[model samples]
Target: MDLLDDESSAGASNAPEFSVSELSGAIKRTLEGAFGRVRVRGEVGRVMKAKSGHMYYDIKDDRNVIACTTWKGQVSGLGVLPEEGLEVIVTGKLSSFSAQSRYNINVDTIEVAGAGALMAMLEKRKAQLAADGLFAPERKQALPFLPEVIGVVTSPSGAVIRDILHRLRDRFPRKVLIWPVAVQGANCAPEVTAAIAGFNQFTPGGALPRPDLLIVARGGGSIEDLWGFNEESVVRAAAASDIPLISAVGHETDTTLIDFASDKRAPTPTAAAEMAVPVRLDLMAWVDGQEARLSRALAQGIGQRQQHLRDLSRALPRPETLLNTAAQRLDLWADRLPNALRAGIQSRQVRLAQAGLRANMLRNLLTTGQERLTTLDRRRPAALTRQVNTARRHLTATTGRLRLSLLQQDVARKSEAYGQLSRRFTDLARAQLQGRRNRLDTLDRLRETLGYQATLARGYAVVRAGDQVITTKAAAAKAGSLEIEFQDGRLTPQMEAKAAKSRKKPDTPPPDQGTLF
Candidate 1:
């Protein structure tokens, strides 16, 4: 039994306590000297990365964040940046940093416990920038619709590059130049600031003109991944640059102080890409519509010209109508002239015939008048003498009757004168009777002396031709026969003229006076 007890004691003394490296490491990870699985809420300060690819930062809450380190490979997939005043929950073993020999948490798995913690620090920074008027709307830039050059501050090799390319290809398809920049991590702010400045300087003399728009973009991640855009220097560079900027640094749900400072904000890199370019199909449709309108205008102009020509045609004059009217007038004149001339000739001929008949009648009447005047001259004086003698006889009878009546008015004168008057009257009557008988006998003798038939009976001759007496001696002597007139019978005489030497002369008779009554 004493030997069993001795074996138990000896085995217990041989048992392993711990290796010194393990002992010190375990001792370093404890409740008293270690900060174990505790949640720290603070703002980050002095954020850094070592050459071995480890990230170190302090966790602060308005004042501090204890020092901590994450191995390069472990934090390689963080897809975010660690920065000052970042709040997180760290699960790790506490250990000494050899350079300062100071104890700190070697971070294992870390999580962002209070995102508002970081926001509180960012809000304070935002207020400071606002008080300085750095984030004022007036301080912001304006974006260009058609940019000749585009500067991008984002991960060098990321999906953001492809997104912008796809958008440019579909929209503008113009020449573009890209400048690579860091999108996240400790060096992101300075690197982005440098890239913006370098692009500005190089833009003046480069193949591409200076950027009209600057697009800061990155793939989606935690808020820390997009924090580079929040840095004051990066923001001021974006604002101060001559170019306009588009902030597309995070997912649709994320927002930052840089968004207010930019000229425009996009939900994501893809959204930024879409905003930069236009669609090609819409331009083609507009060109086709313009062509159709031009074609319609040409058609309308042609129609107007055709109507004008039609109007002009109607207004033109017709020479044929004027000629036809003139011809009709000429034909009317041709039909009337000959008839008028023939009628005028017939009227003139009829007038000439009438005038000739009137002239012949006048000539015959003149010849008859001359013959009547000759007969009247031969007989008119003798008839007037007989009428005068009868008138004298009537006057003598009337005077005698008037005297006889006046004397009968006194009986004594009648008786006394009657005896005387009877004797005287008887004697006177007897004498008057004898005188009247003698006068009557004388008138009978004168008749016998002047009558042509009585002169033929008394052996007288009258030679006449065509009722005219022959009075000339030569006319009577050369005649073959002469008419002899007597008181009772007429005889034709043989008229012989004696020779000129045998002719005898006759004696002259005495003159007588007219008898008184």
Candidate 2:
């Protein structure tokens, strides 16, 4: 306590505080241990990367921000290069350096975060609404084919109101009333619901004119900021409305639950306006078109009637003498035949000459009948030919009987000889040959029983791998060809099956060898 304590106190008083380098090292170590791996999301700006394997950037929100740094090695594998003015989420070890007396995230991963989560949330909400029948085509009330008074629900001061108003004014400014709404933030749901209710209700003074169609709309924003239209109350209010609701919320790509529940969805406020009112010019054009079509139809009808009248006139007949006309036509044909025949007779004289020659030949033959018979009698050789034919027939009959008698005697001798030879033979040789034939037939039948082609015909199957027949369990040890044989042909199935290991046969004891024991 005397010398050493005094000296120690003096040293403590004189010694400088811990160096900045030491403090920084301690802080970095403490932070690394405290927040090993964390995820942070913020807007990115002023991204500066050092060649010494370090990256620096500012992580800002709407109100405040902080400088952030990530070692190059940690963020090298991130597919996207860090850029200014992109909202991103960074995951890394949290570290602090006492030397600089500052803390930064040592980013390990980085990506656009809100888009994926927002997409997922939107998809979930859409699915829920779809299941609830809010998105059913049946639930979507058809827009009054010609809505008279269109109602508008949007921000009173936003560009959306101006856009909707401008479009309505330019196109069909006949009479539209915009029911102002809080389209963003916590109060959005209640405000929109009330606006819709007010339109639907029977209210008195200060009430906006009743609208047959209500337009619910907004401009595009971040998913969170645009989430008010996706709220349950807003959707229910839209679905409950008797007045048809038209939703023009956000950009074309932006989807919300209210869009599904509403009667129709317009991509933007301007589109909603267009949908709510028919263009004056377009209506005028349509009226003209209808008028033209009516004119064309009337003309076609008149022309068709006139043509019908002309056809009837030509087909009609007066009460004149139809019978008299038919009688005259018949009498006119009766005197025409003889004249027709005379005009066709240029070769009749040659035909008459031939007829005369045929008549002369017949007369001459009749006059020489007896002379012709005498000449035939001189030509005849003898009448004994008939007798010769009779005697030859009798001789042939006698020879035939003799031949039949000889044939019987020969057959009797042959039968006796055959009986003697066969009595001395046995049936054993014939039976043995027949048994061998039966065995070969049995083997052929077995092959046909299990053959792949035969089995296919029999409505059975054989799964084969390559060229191998796969006759036994051992042959199909590997999966390969995968051919599926059918009745018509074989097909290689796109899918393959692993070869199953057949169960091993139980081992049998060695044959007994104790015969001499």
Candidate 3:
């Protein structure tokens, strides 16, 4: 046996030998060459994230276990972070760490292995959050119609933030405060939660403007990438936010726990901006339409009033026409009275002459009468003249008095009628004027209530791109620039380049554009 060993050693003296590092390196190369990039399915175990931003974990099946490491750069993009006991599929390259002298996988990506396990976990979390009353509809707050300051929790460098800002600029330009945070990974949840709480801490009207609304946004990705939003801390923070919060974590189909906790859930980041403000041109056009309607109503009312006045005038008798009949009657009475007196005097004279011619005995009477007549003849002329003059004077005096009395009575009657008619006309005019005034006032109030300016006065704002109003996120994105109109003034905010890039991944197609005016 000794002679055989000596012969073998002599024969193998020229053979190459390897050091520990060399052997390890050779083994690593061989493993990489054989497997290259591999997909390993297993249940996660003993996961630990290091302070150096690297992740260390174990993946094991019932019979075998393998160690895995994900560097910080790859961790951000990993759709899901590994948790103990979670079933997952890890894709990575097999390599050896010479210092540790052990083989491990350098993970490139990780994802939930099957839909069933993911759903179970999601259901469990959802049930827990529901039991906590975080998903109750009554717990939600109302979003502002227009926010003066918008707070955003997202990765400042990611496309999600850019998309949100761009959408806001297009919908309504507002002051935006950014709280940079990790969108995904172990650190993502706490940072997001802290950001939400920090925004609430800002004092309103202070040097640092407080947010009226908060937007927790992220771009569309796989379930793992969006898992941070489903974390209990993030969900709780969203539910507890004093400022109204909007969750725009992913595409419409991707829903997270935060969606239920938020006041509103936007299918996409851009959609959140649309929910914030109204189109400026559309509002102005609506105001103009209301004004025109009010004017038409008032004009029609005035025309109706004028027609009523004309009808009233036609129904009333004319003053001059009524007085004419009274004047005619007075003239007829004046003409007949003097004639009647003259006829009575002539008849008496005729009777006296007939008696004188009757008899001789009457002749003595006649002779005496003649003597009387002769004696009276001297004074008769004077007496007759005096009696005629006295009768004429009395008749003249009576006629004058009768005419004067009739004139006064007729004048009084006509005057009283005129006064009554005047009073009635005045009352009618006043009533009509009052009714018109009331109607006009009512119309004015209606106009004010329906006007867009009134809405603006109630803390709303309008958004415009150039002369056009941006009614949708797509339209705003296409516009590239925008103007926000408030009750007091207009603002145009500068958009970042990141926002432009985010427009490329819109979940919905752009809507048709139309003129507001």
Q: After superposing candidate 1, which stretches have Cα over 4 Å from the reference?
A: 1-113, 140-142, 287-517
lDDT against the true structure, each candidate? 0.68, 0.72, 0.82
Candidate 3 runs further than 4 Å off: 1-115, 298-517
The candidates, ranked best first by TM-score, are 3, 1, 2
Residue 408 in candidate 2 has what lDDT?
53
| Backbone-clash count (model 2) | 4
lDDT by residue (tens digit), candidate 2, 28-101: 78778887888888878788878896888887888977677776566535524456766788777787755567
Query: Residue 384 in model 1: shift from native, Å?
Result: 99
Rate residue 153 of model 1 by lDDT.
Answer: 66
TM-score of each: 0.39, 0.38, 0.42
Clashes of each: 24, 4, 4
| Top-down lDDT ranking | 3, 2, 1
Worst 10 residues of 1 by lDDT: 492-501
* Candidate 1 lDDT score at position 186: 59
